[model samples]
Target: MRILLTGSVVATCAFMLFTSGRTLAHDYKLGPLAINHPWSRATPGGSKTGSGYLRVANTGAEPDRLTGGSSPLAERITVHASSTDNEVARMRPVVGGLGLTPGQTVELKPGGAYHLMFEGLRAPLKANDKVPATLTFEKAGSVEVVFDVAAMGAGEGAAKHDGMAPGMHQNGPFQ
Candidate 1:
């Protein structure tokens, strides 16, 4: 009985750590699609928004589309495409969602051209924290995922979070 108790305790501890977003890495799957490295940057207090980034690959012969998703951390999540033109930052909601052709992979990263927007955050996201969210796809339906929070300024060229980690400005870099 004592040995069984110890095993249960250890298992509980590991589960807590992983679920709480303290683990080093995480991954998820929805049928033939592979969801890898879902992540987000910490937000400041009073900020109603945040951002999420990840890579999705469609290994199946059938193509898929990332429509949108939601999270308890925010009012809703939207997939968006952002770009810089002549020193100006421009972002537009992804229309018809993002397409993932067969055997194709796409990365939504900070300071990159694509990303997820978490609007109306319930509260600020602190570094090393994790946010729970979901991704809705046209083909695979929906899958629950966790966003590993980084230090608001993580990665080679992370976004800025003065307010909501918009990482966008009329001028200058999104970094």
Candidate 2:
């Protein structure tokens, strides 16, 4: 009985330690940018592209924009926006950047005013995995975040529509 009790305690401790380490391993902060609910989609092998989503809350009294971002996986990164026009969803790069008014939170969600354009991916993003991203803002500077990769075709129309996160349709890189 004593051996069994000891074994149970040891097992519980081991489990707690393992879980704690996993959580700590994934915890990262990106300066003033409080990244929340970041997610992405799985991509094919050799594919040079992927997308990321997150929310940014500006706790200051000034406005800002997500000007730029970078990652070792991408050759180029840009902020974009997509919307519906004439019943057709069109994507255009949001010139300048996404605006964040004072005390207003901007969502880098799907099918809305913000999208992360990853140009060159070093490896395929697997489902249920995490991808590292570095986001830059005009006033907030740069922040690093890990995007939890969801299934492909998962992030469709998450901003305006009721469906899953469809891809976005916005204009070119910022000027």
Candidate 3:
């Protein structure tokens, strides 16, 4: 029984070691701002276009706005919003910044107000792959976030937190 117990302990340690790094998803920190759960959809290899998502939280006493973003992996990054009107789904550029109130949270998910449009994808993103991006905020400066690729059509139900009602595009960025 001594040998068996030793083996079990070793096995458990190995499992934890392997899985520990897996849970450490990419994160970006800037002063009192933390961007969490950065994720994106895996696109076909060599595809020049893709999308990214994440959640932003401000732990400071002042408000902030996500002005824009950039990445070496893509030609350009733009903030976009998707909406459905008369059964039509449309996307448009968010001219103003995504507003963030002190101690508030904003989620960027699929088919809703928060979206990262990658114009020039350097490499096709595959499921389980990771992508790098630099998020720019008006008050918090810029921070790097690693976006984990999510399965296609996996974020269908993530649009209700910020009043992203069904069938309609969200109205402006959160403040």
Q: Among these predicted structures, which one has the highest lDDT?
A: 1
TM-score of each: 0.75, 0.67, 0.72
**lDDT (tens digit, per residue) of candidate 2 on 1-175:** 3555588799877766665544433333444444445667788888888877766666667788887678777776787787887899876677898787766666776666667777778788888776677778887787677677777877543222111122221111111
- lDDT tens digits by residue: candidate 3, 1-175: 3555588799877765664454344344688787755778878766788887777778899999888789888888888888889998898778877888999877777866667788888788787676778889998898877777766655744322223333322222332
Q: Give the range where candidate 2 is weakest over 10 consecutive residues by summed lDDT.
A: 166-175
Candidate 1: lDDT over CA atoms? 0.77
**What does candidate 3 score on TM?**
0.72
Best of the candidates, TM-score: 1
Model 3 error, position 152 (Å)? 3.3
Mind giving the per-residue lDDT tens digits that candidate 1 earns over 1-175?
Answer: 3545588799877666554442223456789987766888888899997888987879799999999899988899998999999999998899989999998888899788889999999899998787888899998999998887888678734322222214332232221
Superposition error at 168 for model 2 (Å): 25
| Regions of candidate 3 where Cα sits further than 4 Å from its true position | 1-20, 156-175
lDDT of each: 0.77, 0.65, 0.71
RMSD of each: 10.7, 9.4, 8.4
Model 1 misplacement above 4 A:
1-25, 156-175
Better of 2 and 3 by lDDT: 3
Q: What's the ranking of the predictions by lDDT, best on top?
A: 1, 3, 2
